[model samples]
Target: MKAFVVYCHPSEDSFTRHVRDSFIKGVVDSGNEYELSDLYKMNFQTDMTEKEYLRDSNYRTTPGLAEDVLAEQRKINSSDAIVFIYPVFWTDVPAKLKGWFDRVWTYGFAYGEKSMKLLQKGLVLCTTGHTKSELKKYKLLESMEKVMLGDRLFKKVHDAEFIVFDGMTKACDLREKNWNKNLETAYQKGKNLFAPRS
Candidate 1:
């Protein structure tokens, strides 16, 4: 199986980058092929042009998608599984990724008479400054999952999961404490990407 990884972090010197690399290594070792869209590195255009917005709002699917958007859509159709790796910013994905959705999830592709293929799995591996317990205390974790899994990946993938590598902010002691453990989990997740969930 092939996995399409949408990685969106701006810095190379980050725990999130380590998580991404470890996961890719595991996927390779498991004998699976993968494609990567490093949004920052590739300078992915995330903004939705006025014309683009109008087209979606009007439910127009006349085959005039931007090349970048079309490229991302092609990646989704080709891959058997999709993986999203990034850091949580303001209780959500970074702006670039949000824009990626806005621009790429056009009418008749990701929604509304969709042409996108149903994938085997959808997985999110996100790092956060807050602890999972803290996010749960305020129901933020639940909200995040609902948005990502329930809305975005819903009906697009047969199986879906959301994973947070939490408490990794520079000011948090747990950042250092959980570093290796979190990376190992990410690697294992990739290694078992195609395995049946029990």
Candidate 2:
């Protein structure tokens, strides 16, 4: 199986980057193929043109999506699984990623007479400064999962998972303590991504 990994982060000096690399290593070791879209490195055009906004808003099935958007759609359709890796920004994905959705999830593609394939799995691997307990206490974790799995990945993938790499800020002592452990988990997740779906 092949996985399309959408990695969004502004810096190379981040735990999230490590997570991406480690996971990819595991995927390679497991003999699975992958395609990567590093949004920042690609300088992805996230903002939608007025024409696009109007087309989607009107539910128009006009086939004039931007080249970048079409490329991403092709990636989605060609892969068996999809993975999103990023740091949580205000209990949500980064603005670039969110805009990716706005532009790529176009009419007659992601919605209305959709042509996007239904992948076997959709996975979210997010880094957060807040501890998991804090996220749970306030139910922010649920909100995050709902946005990604319930809404965006809903009906888009057969199964989904939301992974939290919590307490990852420099201010948190756990950052150093849990760094390797978290990366190990990421590697394992990728290594087993297409392992009979168990």
Candidate 3:
């Protein structure tokens, strides 16, 4: 199986980067192939150009998408599954990734008269500074899931999942305590991503 991994992280000295590496290792160990798009490293353009906005707003399928946007679309079509790895910022995806959705998931491709394929799976792995309980306490987790799984990824993939590694604040004791465990979970998720379940 092949997976397209969209990794968005600004700093290499971060736990989120480690998660990405661990997951990639698991994918390799499972004998699966992957294509990685390190958004920050690639300096991917996230802002939608005026022309892009005009095209989507008018629902025009003029095949005028930018080369970068088309490249991302091609990656999606060529993969069996899609994996998104990032660190949560302000209870939502980082602005870079959100902008990616804005640009890459164009109207014709992800919505009306869509030609995008229904992939086998869509997985989101996000790290949060807040603990899971804290997130649930304010219903932030549910809201995050709704936006990601219920809306953005909705109908775009056959199956989708949102997984967060919480309590990763720099000051939190649990951050260091659970670091290995969190990465192990990430690795396992990658290993079993394409495995059949009965």
Candidate 4:
């Protein structure tokens, strides 16, 4: 299976990176082909310019990123599944990571105003947060789900799964344990999501 892992974290020595690496290890150990897109390492531009937005193009256009976006779109098109790993700040994704979305996931490629078939097949969201899981837990917190899965990623894509790992502020054995557990869980989920269909 081919998996595209999109990781978003500023600090290279951060706990988020640890989680990302562990997850990648699972994919490697499973003998699956994968691609890693590190937003920070790429120094991706996150904001869209007014003039670029004004253009009537269906796909996202940056000052100097037309070719790059096209390249990413081709990668996404070839992948069997996509994994987005990042640390949630203020209950949202990093600006650069979001920018990756704005720039790459274009209309004709990711979705269409008419046809609704998403170019990508499987979509998985593996995310972390600074706060504890209990604090952010809410019964009606489906907004993120809808936007990332239901609306954006899943709108064009068919099969999808949402997996989240919360609580990272308090660092200790407990945090490590939970994080590892979540990593294993996500790994297995990714394997299943990208498994070749019979």
Candidate 5:
């Protein structure tokens, strides 16, 4: 299997980067091919230009997608599975990632007689400052899952999963305690990404 990993983090020094590396290691160890898009490293253009906006709004498929957007679309088409790795900000994906969806999931591609390929899997691995209990108490975790799985990835993949490595705040003791465990889970997820559904 080939997995396309979309990793978005501002710094390489962070734990999220380690999560990414560990996951990739698992993919490699599993004998699967992988492609990575390090959004921060690429300095991807997130903001939608007016022309791009008009194109989507008007439902016109005149074929003027920017090269960057087309490149991302191509990656999606070529992959067997898609994985998104990021850190939660304000209970949502980072603006950079949100903008990636806004810009790259273009008209006639992600929607409107879509050209986007339906991948075998869509997996999201996000780090959160709040503990899972805290997020569940307020139903924030459900909201995040609904947005990512029910909305953004709806009908786009055969199966989808949303996993959070929670309690990652610097001041939280669990951050250190669960660090290795969380990464092991991430690696396992990658290793088993293409396993048959049971």
Candidate 6:
């Protein structure tokens, strides 16, 4: 199977990067070909232009910007699975990563006329947070569901199996032993999710 991984993180040494790598390893071990788009590294822009909206009611009309959109569409079109790896910053994904969705998952390209469901075959979300578990428990889970799945992505894609593994506040865990274990488990979950169906 082909897999497309969208990684969102600014720091190269971050736990988010590790988790992304682990997922890639798992996919490779499973003998699947995959592609990756590292948002921060690639310098993805999340802003939507007014002119784009003015042009033909299509979200991606600019020629230069259209290329990026088409590239993402091709990746999505070619893949059987899609994974989003990022660290939850301020209760949301980074702006650059969000921009990838804004630019790539266009109205007509990624969705339209109930045809938008085309992108949802095998989608998974892998995320981490700087806040501790207690913090999340105390709060309302920071509305991750609404922000990530509901507003940004879920509705844009079709019906598919989705899961989350949130590793929190790893900075306090300097050694990262516990964090690594959690990441390993999450990687296993991702692997299982993409394993060939029986």
Every model's TM-score: 0.99, 0.98, 0.98, 0.79, 0.98, 0.78
Q: Which lDDT tens digits does candidate 4 get at residues 1-198? A: 677788888888776787677767777777887898888888767776565455426353323547767667667767767777877665567778788877675554554542223434555454544434443466323555566777657555556666666655556455666866776776665555556445
TM-score, candidate number 5: 0.98
| Cand. 6 Cα-lDDT | 0.64
Q: List all candidate RMSDs to the true structure.
A: 0.6, 0.8, 0.9, 3.9, 0.8, 3.5
Q: Which segments of candidate 6 are over 4 A away from where they belong?
A: 56-65, 114-126, 130-139, 155-167, 196-198
Q: For model 6, what is the alpha-carbon lDDT of residue 61? A: 39
Alpha carbon lDDT of each predicted model:
0.95, 0.95, 0.92, 0.64, 0.94, 0.64
What's the CA error at residue 196 for candidate 5, in Å? 2.2
Model 3 C-alpha lDDT per residue in residues 83-171, reported as the tens digit of each score = 99999999888889998999999988998999898999999999999999999999999999999999999998888989999998798
Q: What is candidate 2's lDDT per residue for 109-196, written digit by digit as tens?
A: 8898999999998999999999999999999999999999999999999989999999999899999999999999999989999876
Deviating ranges (above 4 Å) for candidate 2: none
lDDT-wise, the better of 3 and 4 is 3
For model 5, the superposed segments whose C-alpha errors exceed 4 Å read none
In model 2, residue pairs whose N, Cα or C atoms come closer than 3 Å (at least 3 residues apart or on different chains), thus clashing, are none
The whole-model C-alpha lDDT of candidate 5 against the native structure comes to: 0.94
| Local error of candidate 2 at residue 131 (angstroms) | 0.5
lDDT of 2: 0.95
Report the lDDT tens digits of candidate 6 across residue range 1-198.
Answer: 777888888888776677788778877877777899887777766776765556426543344546666777788777766777877666666778777776676655555533233454445554554434644686635576656656656655454444445545455553354677766765675566555445
Q: After superposition, how far is residue 68 of candidate 5 from its true place, in Å?
A: 0.4
Backbone collisions counted per model: 0, 0, 0, 1, 0, 2
